[model samples]
Target: MRINVLQHTPNEGPGMIEDWANAHGHPMVTYHPYQFGHLPNADETDMLVILGGPMSPNDAQPWIKQERTLIQTLRSRAVPMFGACFGAQQISKTLGYEVTKAPAKEVGWAPVYRQSTVIPGIPAELTVLHWHEEMFEVPTAAQLLFASERVTNQGFVLDHRIVGLQFHLEPRANNVREMVVNDYPYIQGSQLNQTAADILTMPVLAANQRALFHILDYITADN
Candidate 1:
């Protein structure tokens, strides 16, 4: 399978996704738009992964505009796309939902309550990583996949293919440490009160990777 990753920053590259693809010997293409100033041709890959970044979807920037346009185009074709954190926020916004600040930052390990009315491929329960100060409203045409008190719209599925997950399912401890030091300034006084040490080795961390695998297997399978 050819999986394309849209990486907005150097530090926030694909973590477990890279490991899984390498282990499975699947072809991979990474679109570092922030550095390259352009995204790859959507027709080149079988899957699309919109990774997380610090910037909001509403940011007024040229690359942001390009990404939004690309996502919209992919959605029009019903491409099997999976979005994480800011990518989820962008998907929500592109699909007519609102993305805004939540009551809390919701950093670290958190239990995501998988809805009984979940997509056919997702697990019944998932303990994913959290590291966002914003959340998005569910698109009207999508089914709610998961929820949490901290962020009601934890996950959503559209057309039984596209998915948007606000929490991090592939969050690695090393990446968490990098985010703590690099993204500390943004969350320092925001609603999400957390530090790198608080969740580096939390038990829930293991489930995050499992959840990502389950999700990937589900989405990549023949429909």
Candidate 2:
């Protein structure tokens, strides 16, 4: 299978998703949408994964508009799409949904209450990584997959093909550290903000990342 990943920033590249793609011998292509502009043929890809960023989905940036258009096209075709954080907001917004500030910001690993009991192997609840200040409303027909204290719409599965997750299923220790050092300003003034020291000092996010792969494999299975 072919996978096209849209990277929004230099540091926020696809994390464990790269491992899955490479291990399975899936052809991987990346588009720095901010640099190359809104990829004209996004829907032509077999699977689309949009990474997170500091920018809002409503940002006035030129590529933002292009991405929005691309997202709309992808949705119309029901192409398998996976979005994280701001990418999730973009997906929800393009699909006639809304994105807004959450009541509180969750910056550390938190438990996700899985409402979709159909997910196999994993427990009904799990601790997932969190990093977004904004949240997205599930598309009207999408099913709720999980929820956290700060956001009721932590995840929504669409047509069993597209998925929007508020948390980072792609997180690794290094990415968490880089985010802490660079994106610290966003959390510094906020109340539930956890430092990179707080997250990196912990034991096991990679295991959780592996679990994330399993969940996604279940969602985007070709068979």
- Expressed as tens digits, the lDDT of each residue in 96-144 for candidate 2 is 7778888777777678887786556546667776777789989888888
Q: Give the Å error, residue 72, model 2.
A: 2.2
Mark the 10 consecutive residues where model 1 has the least summed lDDT: 186-195
What is the per-residue lDDT of model 1 for residues 59-117, given as tens digits with 9 covering 90 to 100? 88788778878788887876778899988888889887789987778876667888745
| CA-only RMSD, every prediction | 2.2, 1.9
**lDDT of prediction 1:** 0.77
Pairs in clash, predicted candidate 1:
105-191, 105-192
lDDT of 1 at 67: 81
Question: How accurate locally, in lDDT, is each candidate?
Answer: 0.77, 0.78
| Model 1 lDDT at residue 216 | 75
